[model samples]
Target chain A: MKILFLGFGNVARRLAAIVTDEGWPSRRGTFPVEVVGLFTASRGSLAGAVDLARARAELEATGRFDARHPLRTDMTPLEASRNLDYDVLVELSPLAIEARGEPAVSHIASALARGRHVVTANKGPVAFAYRKLAALAETQGVRFLFESSVMDGAPLFNMARVALRGCRVEAFAGILNGTTNAILCHMERGGSLEEGIAAAQAAGIAEADPSHDVDGWDGAAKTAALANVLMEADVTPFDVERRGIGSVSVGEVRRALAAGRRLKLVCRACRREGAIQTSVAVEEVAADDPFSLVDAYGAILRIETDLMHPLVLTQEGPEVMDTAYGVLNDLMEIAGTAERKGEEP
Target chain B: MKILFLGFGNVARRLAAIVTDEGWPSRRGTFPVEVVGLFTASRGSLAGAVDLARARAELEATGRFDARHPLRTDMTPLEASRNLDYDVLVELSPLAIEARGEPAVSHIASALARGRHVVTANKGPVAFAYRKLAALAETQGVRFLFESSVMDGAPLFNMARVALRGCRVEAFAGILNGTTNAILCHMERGGSLEEGIAAAQAAGIAEADPSHDVDGWDGAAKTAALANVLMEADVTPFDVERRGIGSVSVGEVRRALAAGRRLKLVCRACRREGAIQTSVAVEEVAADDPFSLVDAYGAILRIETDLMHPLVLTQEGPEVMDTAYGVLNDLMEIAGTAERKGEEP
Candidate 1:
């Protein structure tokens, strides 16, 4: 099986390295998977342009790669489809829902239409058009997996759909975004709300504008994915009632701390009166509670079930690198299963 | 697919109830699994004597049952084998390793030899004779799933084997036994060691003797399971260094608390120089750390991998009921795949 990766972003770079290091093609039981080519963003360079010739020479010296295929980054979706003879596509690009129309989405749609399996760390397409893309995947008889879209490298999607199977999921809630959680933790530590936000930006944990992370749009998109795909709930972005952390005040933060509580931005999706309701809000959690100790970029999910007790799963830290690894992990599962089923691979 | 439960312990009772309540038999998308009969340890009054009779009654009222072959709790394994007809054998009997002369192990072996698929929550057979039983399962082309054996209801086996595929696991450490953790947590909360033990007994959380839990034998068994299955490290029960929380003192717990740390009984398995080492010890964890917040009966696994960072997966509240549910969850996954493969329903 030959694989093509679109965009040399953090996720793509990490995945490519893992693929090579794991010896995908030569692993004892592997089904001959090979990373054929990589395409970066039009503005970026291949493998960060660390001298492809030099890199290839080094890999050859180490007896790792016999040959390296360098593809131009500026190819259109149609161009990529016609030129690439790969069995699977790894889509990792900057998430853009409105303005740029997200190259990852178009690339994924094109790959699926071409009857190639598509694995992605990109949440844009899944959150915006899950049903459509899923149907397309079925029609093409390929797999479309996005485990990293919700909790970075954590198996949030798999846990909900597979691990917690047969149990009636009464509700699902979590501290989904790390940036907002980091800011909340800072404020609870006596830092002013503005100071916390500035600290997050300084640490490169938050974007300059930070609208998506701070305004809860990023988390809303994730919650939508969790609801529709994981829980099989029919819901959309517009259905959610989002309240970002931008409105939280320093006084309120201090007051919460004084009362032995910490302010946490929580996202929840649950069935209420036979309708799925999604909400993002800032709530004060007791200092002794598990949510109170969630550090910078840490995520936790509380799945209330019809059983005697609820199931709580958590993951710490917010490294896009892990999120990238999560995407690769999902691909491996789908690819392995597909190969076992005597598919194209 | 008819299932005959071999025991009426906590796990068996819970699983029977869940299978019935879910309308499992009528769920056509997956396997054609159905609960046909149940056998308890006691005779005559066994069905009525069971604590959760309401759950049993509810299942009987809705779920299809073979009236001509009403569940019998008194029959010997050999008698049941000759008289009853079941496609699957679910063993939830109390674990008895030393009593190898007893029927459980032989019954399991007989079930496998008869081409009956086995799903067990018992650890005795697997922990004692993993190689023999695993070989038997493979020879018979039947699934021998024991997700509940290691960490109660957590997806430890599935996560280590399936979720973390292709990743080089360096080490794993966990709080494996909930009963021991609950006792330690109680002791940390100003109770004497003896008092905590009493509290556990009163709460029905600990066994009468409690040696298995307090002496670290229980965690040792679980650690063995993790090392052998998850890390693919060949290690035996005798190879592990076992140390429980029985020796912890109030002064030590107080000092650890003063140092902003908490004491926890930790089970660790690591590969060192191509050799596997397993141990159970007491460790001091920082208050703000994830393990510190793990309350009574909660279990946590910190899996160190060669990836960007370590991944920690935890299941809160160690309850047999939850563990039973986890086992049922595994059965569902296996049954689903088996059905898809056109195996015997």
Candidate 2:
């Protein structure tokens, strides 16, 4: 299948590598994936435009590539739509929430309008305009899958829709933001709030301007997407009550640890008397509990149901890669089925 | 949608109550499910037959019975097929493996042949003849879902197919047979092997014969289903190395517990050096490990993948209900999509 990748970030790079390596093992053995084109946010050349020349030189010394994937920087959505004959579009562009007229949203919307399936890691499009985008996909008979938008690649979307079938999900609670969770873990281990933030930054777990993750916006975005898409709840990011790890102090962390408890940034959404309420809070988890042992940026979803006991699902590690692969897998399933049906009758 | 039930067992009774009462809340809220017909093996009149009487009593006790949803007994497969006008068949008959050539298989085959989706809790047809049955369902363009055949209702089948998508499952290890797991849990708590077996019988966890579960054949059957259907590894029950929990002595259990370990009847299927091998054995799990905490009939599937970490999923109670619901859910998704498409151009 001919594929077009939008953006040249970490996820985009990994996807490019996986698709280009023919003999690489997929979960189903060595199936080859061909990447026909890549479009990045640059011009001149990634090698020429690199302000960090030393890092570029070190990367070039390895002989992998003198430059990154080719950047079609000047191509507009309309031009790309007419020019590219790709089967699917992989959208990995960095999110732009304030710019309601961003290129990523237009790119995705245009791709679906052209009846091309979209596999996206961008949460902004879905979180902001899910109903419009999903309805558009349905009308065009193409899939608009964004499995990575919620929990990286942990099957959180699939679990809600498929695994917990025939059961009403009353509540969904989890540790969503990895940066905050990492900082909280450090704080619980006797580090001051500032020290923990510094540790997270040093470990590359926190962004330079960490307001999105540390101030609970990231978790709220994920919660909105999950609730709206998976649970079919009418909600938005602004609807949730946001409380990040920024409120917790060194004294509070130490006191909790002394009481044999660990502080965890918890995100939860539930139907209360037919109204949906969501919040992110730092809760003290007991030592023997599973949440206490969730080390780093791990995520756990506790779903409350009526028929059976509460189902607790815990997923650990860097989930972005898994999420990317999940999006690819869904695309494969949808595309394979569609291709087969087109060939039949 | 009219549903035809093939048996009047506990599961069938529960499902009938849910359907007739329309009390079960779906994604669209409490929608009515009308049960048009029911069939049981009893020969007496519909009102007097033991199975029919029990079903009626249960439905009445739950206050879910309506005069519109009448009961029927002594209905042959052809008679019910012609009379009911049901869109789906719920097969909950007592599994008669000895009579492989009997009407249960033929009835199921005919139901699928006539384009009625089949949701079964019966293991007889699937364990012995999955290939033929699955091929028939494919030919008929309907689903043959038997989630309860393996783990009562704990999303085991769906988990393998959907949740763990895009990853090569290297191995599946679990305590599949609940009766044996219950026995082992009791034995680990200082009861003798015989005493534990007796307790299992008293608690209705084990059958009177108890050979199928305790002798490891039950777990072997479930392992075969998982391997064949989930992993797409063509395997039969006979291919598995069956070792029942009966082999584990009381002294061994005591010794294992003394060493801060608990004995569990473990069923494992893996691709070892490119060859699929499965077995049931007594493994000593560490006290602090998740496997050790699986008490009573609870089952856990530790799926090893090519990814960075293994996923451990535990289902705490009767798994058959979840499996049955999974089958129903799959049918709903497939059928719902088809119905919607049929409405379109």
Candidate 3:
């Protein structure tokens, strides 16, 4: 199989490493695949699989590409995506929550328009236009899979979509944003929010500008995406009743901890009567609840369904590796579908 | 689709209710299917889909059949299985751990021989004869799925088999037996082991004879089944380095609780030096650990794999409804496979 990557960030690079180290997963088994093209907004583009660590380092240090690399290209992602010979298009672009899934949506749509399968880790397309993009994929005879959008590599969406065939997902509550949780935990330990952000940023767990996470936009976007896909809410991130941890004080966190409860910015989506309701706000979780126990870097999702009982899926200390796993798993799903129909990988 | 149930018990009745209330899952959509047959050891057999409430009541009250029942028969499951025309076999037979998955294994083999798909909740076939039974199903071009055999309806195995296709499961540690966890929790709460068994039995979570659970055989069986399928351990429950909570003392439980730890009967299976090692033993979990917070009736499984992060799956207060979902989901999987191949369901 040949592939084109939209953004060559940490996630895309991690996936590239997995395919090179562990090989690509397909219906038959794992095997090597060609990484035909790689694109990035910061570092220009590459035409073939080549060592990218030095390129990323030089771009970070010099704020520009080395310009001497043999595979360097001036071609845009759109140009490579349309002209490249590849069976799958991997979209690992940074999320644009405020833009409401913009260029990423166009990229995925272009790939699906050309009858190519898409495996993405971006939340923009799902939160803003799940139904339309999914319909486009179906119309073009391909798949649009995003397992890393919510909780990286957790497979919560796959559980609802594939393994849970007969059951109907009635509702969900999750601690979706790790940055906010880390901020809260830091405050509980008598530190300020800035200190928490700095700590997380140093650990590579939070971005330099964490306005989206601190303002609950990231959690709201994930909530909208999950609700739109699983509950068919047909809603966007702005539709959710949202709040952030900016209003939560250190005294409040310490008091909640003293009372054997933890303050969490909980993202919840449920059906009330016939309409779907989404919310992201700070809530006090009891000591015994599973959500109260997850660390700052951990995530937990509780799903209430019809036939199956309420299931709680948790992943603690998840890093970039987990997000890359989601991309690879989605690719494997597409390949498995094709192989079932006797198509070449 | 037509189904033949090998053992008509609470689980089978629960599935019947799900199909009747929520409808059967298929490639097309939710639709009703025929429950062509129901076979039981003590209550005799029924030839068609009959209201079984009165029959089950009668069997429990008087332990005999009312000759006036229209669909009543003395036909053995084997006899009915041989002569019946059905697309799938729903096996909810009781576990015969000491028998090493007997009668269930033989019955499932017969169904596979007849080229019929099988969905089972019994652990016997998985613990003792997974390879042979799976091979037989493949030879007959059918599926032999046993999701309920391990985690009720949590979908841990499904995550490994269907979703996490490319990644390999490196190891697993779980509180696989709910009864044992319940017992340990009860003992920690200043109750005796006998009181714990009584509480679980009162809640209908434990069998009348709790010997298998207290002896650690149940957890060992689940460990072996999980290791065999996920890690290719190829060993039985007896092969595990096993111990039961029966030897746990009340003083020990209280002391552990006082020390900010909870003693749990943890079932662990890992690949050590290219060989799978399975063990079930009592371990102390710190207060900060997620396992320390689960209630007596709750279950927690932490799976370690390559690519994907460590996944922790937990289910609390699961009832017969969840197990029924497992069987239905497996049925839907078979139907999905058939639908992909354009075969008549």
Candidate 4:
């Protein structure tokens, strides 16, 4: 599988490292994944298959791609995408939620139009244009799989797609964002919301602009993505009834604890009156609720289905590796090389 | 798909009903599933194609199979199995945990030997002869799937098999038995162990002879099945370091609760040193543990891997429908009829 990466950032770099590392054992020998092209907005793009380790060393010491580097090209990601011979395109660009999944959507649409499979870690395209892209992929007979989009590569979507096939997802409630969860945890430890945000930043859970985490846009985006893809609701982040924990006080947190409940930034989605209702709010959950047991750095998604009882999935402290492995798993699936079965390592 | 059912009990009856009920809405269109044969130890046997709804009425009215019942057979399960024409064999007989999975194992082995796919709800085969059956299926180019064998169709094994492909399992700990959990829950409410057992039996959580559940044999079987299939451990239920909650006293439960911990029957497996180690025992879990939140009627499995963070799966109050759906889901996967993608309900 020849892969074209849209960004050369942390997740993408780790993906390349894992794919290229011979010491990393994949089941049933190895999958033939070659990095044929790479494009970065700041770092120069590579037009053809090249060794990433050599390129990384050059980029670190020389600070830029010039005549010294092989396969270096001046073409933009769009131009290089058409020129390069690749089987799948992996998108790992940073989230631009404010612009509603901008250039990423355009890039994916272009790739789909050209009849190429796509694997992405971007939430914008899924949150903003899931219906349009899914319909387009269906018309082309190729798939648009983003297993890492919503839950940091926890395999929630794939579980719904494969193992739980024929079962309709009726409703879901989850803690999708790690940032606000950390802030809530901080508040439970006697810190105010302001101090909580700072603590989250210090722990690298909150980004420089904490608005997305505190203002509920992150959770709203994830909710919209899940609702649109799994629930077939053509909704966007803007449609969510959003609230955040910005108003939470330390005293309120203590009171809830005394009452045997803990505050959480809960994301919920369900169909009501023939339409999907999406919301992200801070609520007091009982001690017995699975949502209350997820650690500050963890996440949990509880889904009700037509065929089974209430099913819940949880994850603890996902890092870049989780998201990177998710993208790699998607690539393997798109390449139809995901035949790891009937064995133990 | 023509299905040969080895037993016509509650689970098989529900499966037939769900498959034939026109009012039930399955995703996409209906899957063509026809009951071709059934062999019950006491409920009688039916061979060839059967309209289960009509056959069920006849069996209830007559209470025996004779010339009046179409396709009635005097052959044993093995004899009828050889004469039947079917694509897959489904085993839903009573658990023969004490007999090391008994006749169900023989029935499944016969089906696999003929190069046919097998989906079973029996744990004995998997716990006692997983390596042999799996090896046989591989050599015959057939699959032996038993998703309902553990966790009551929570999709744990399938999750490890499909969604987490290429990832290696490092360790797992779970509350896998509902009867023991229910008993412990009753004890938490100031009930004695004897009272707890009576309550479990009264609530239908325990069978007439609840030894398999209370004595930890059921969990041990599931543990061995998981270890044998997922971890490549060739151990049986008898090999598990097993203990039961029958020794748990009410005062001990109260003491654990006062220390902010809960008593649970935890089934665990890990590769220790150079071999797989399996255990099923009653232990105290912290209040914040995911196991602590699982309801008396619920179950949870936490898995650690080398590729990603700790992944957890949970289910609440599973019933006959959950196990029946599991069998149906396995049938769909085996028939190559699980092509559900790029769409919504």
DockQ measured for candidate 3? 0.60
Please report, as a residue range, the 10-residue window in candidate 4 chain A with the lowest summed lDDT: A336-345
Candidate 2, position A131, lDDT: 83
Q: Count clashing residue pairs per candidate.
A: 4, 11, 0, 0
Estimate, for each residue in A152-205, the C-alpha lDDT of model 2 and write its tens digit.
Answer: 766666666565655677777787778888887787777877787788788876
Which residue pairs of candidate 3 clash?
none
**Which is the winner by DockQ between candidate 1 and candidate 4?**
4
lDDT of 3 by residue, B147-217 (tens): 88888877876767766777678899988788889889999889999999999899888899998899889
What's the best-to-worst order under DockQ? Answer: 4, 3, 1, 2
Pairs in steric clash, model 4: none
- Residue lDDT tens for model 1, B143-226: 777778876767666665556666677898888788778877887788888888888899887889988788887777778767
On DockQ, the leading prediction is 4
Per-residue C-alpha lDDT of model 4 across residues B243-330, encoded as one tens digit per residue: 9987888999999999999999999999889888999999999887888887677888988887799899999999888999888788
Model 1 chain A worst lDDT run, 10 consecutive residues: A43-52
TM-score (chain A only) of candidate 4: 0.92
In angstroms, the error of model 1 at A325 is 1.9
Q: Which stretches of candidate 4 lie over 4 Å from their true place?
A: A25-29, A56-67, A337-345, B24-26, B57-67, B337-345
For candidate 2, the TM-score is: 0.81
Residue A189 accuracy (lDDT) in model 1 = 81
Which has the higher TM-score value, candidate number 2 or candidate number 4? 4
At residue A321, candidate 1 shows an lDDT of 70
List, residue by residue over B1-345, the lDDT tens digit for candidate 2. 556676655676555444444355544322334455666665221321124344568555754433444453455755675556666777777555346425667777878888877777766677666777789999987778786776676566666566565567788888778888888878877887788789989986677887877878777777777777756677766778988887888789889888988888888999988888888877889854667767888777776765424556666666445544654555455555455457210
